[model samples]
Target: MLDQQITRSIRKMIEAREERVRNGDANGYGVDFFGMLLQSPVNSNISLQDIVDECKTFYFAGHVSSSALLTWTVVLLAMHPEWQERARKEVIQVLGSDTPSFDGLAQLKIVR
Candidate 1:
């Protein structure tokens, strides 16, 4: 029941994003996942169920795992201020006032 509700909600979000992308609203860092999927050749013939499944996959793997990772990283950082400072300095050096791009993030070895 709850899963169905979540799926429907996600489907609505995907439809809205698709419309927004068609209207040229997808710009800057506000890129929409569904919009990208709808446009991608890899997702040809994708149905609403597919989008829901993708969102669910993101919830299970990406969202949940990232949350747990962030929690642990915060705890570890609190225990080690020196490492935290080192991480901050490296971020500034690597990013250097530029918005974080996929390529830039990939180049940040310390982030891994």
Candidate 2:
């Protein structure tokens, strides 16, 4: 029952996002992730289902890595609150008012 509800919700979310992408509402984000994927030269011949299947693969792969990193971070933070504050301070000092982003991440030598 819960699985069906989750599936339906995800279907609706994807449909809404697809509608937004088709209508060019994705321009708000500057570089639309999904729009770029769908229009990519390498993916041009692939069907929508192929795109979806590839997405599922990436989602599951990322989920594991992200969850593990988050779990370990939380555990370490709980064990060392002092270190947590220092890490947060360093991150803020390096990022310095700019939002955390992929482009910004590349510039953070201390972080990378």
Candidate 3:
């Protein structure tokens, strides 16, 4: 039952993205892994279930790695005050007082 709910939710998001793409809304489906998956000619023979499974795998793998990386990054930053300060300065210079957008985050070379 939980799996069904998750599948249904993902399906809805996929359908919505498809609709946006169909309507020529570039901003709506801007540059994402799943968007690329949806648009890829390589995926022509793949089923929605296959895509969903791939997404789940990507999500779980990314979640684990990202958590581990974040923990290590924090610990390393704590151990290295100079690098941490540099990163902080870079973030402040790139993002200023505003919340970090994709472009803003991309501009933060040190922190990235």
Best by TM-score: 1
Residue lDDT tens for model 2, 32-99: 44444454434357665555655555566778987898899889888998977777777787778864
Give the TM-scores of the predictions, in the order they appear: 0.57, 0.47, 0.54
lDDT of 3 by residue, 9-95 (tens): 888988998888788875645456787556543436767788787777778678888789999999999999999999998988888
Q: Which digits, one per residue and each the tens of the lDDT, describe model 1 over residues 51-104?
A: 678778887779878898999999999999998888888889999998665456
Question: What C-alpha lDDT values do all the predictions have?
Answer: 0.72, 0.62, 0.77
Over 4 Å off in model 2, which ranges? 1-27, 30-57, 109-112
Residue pairs in clash, model 1: none
For each of the candidates, give the backbone clash count.
Answer: 0, 0, 0
Per-residue error (Å), model 3, residue 29: 13
Q: What TM-score quantifies how close candidate 3 is to the native fold? A: 0.54
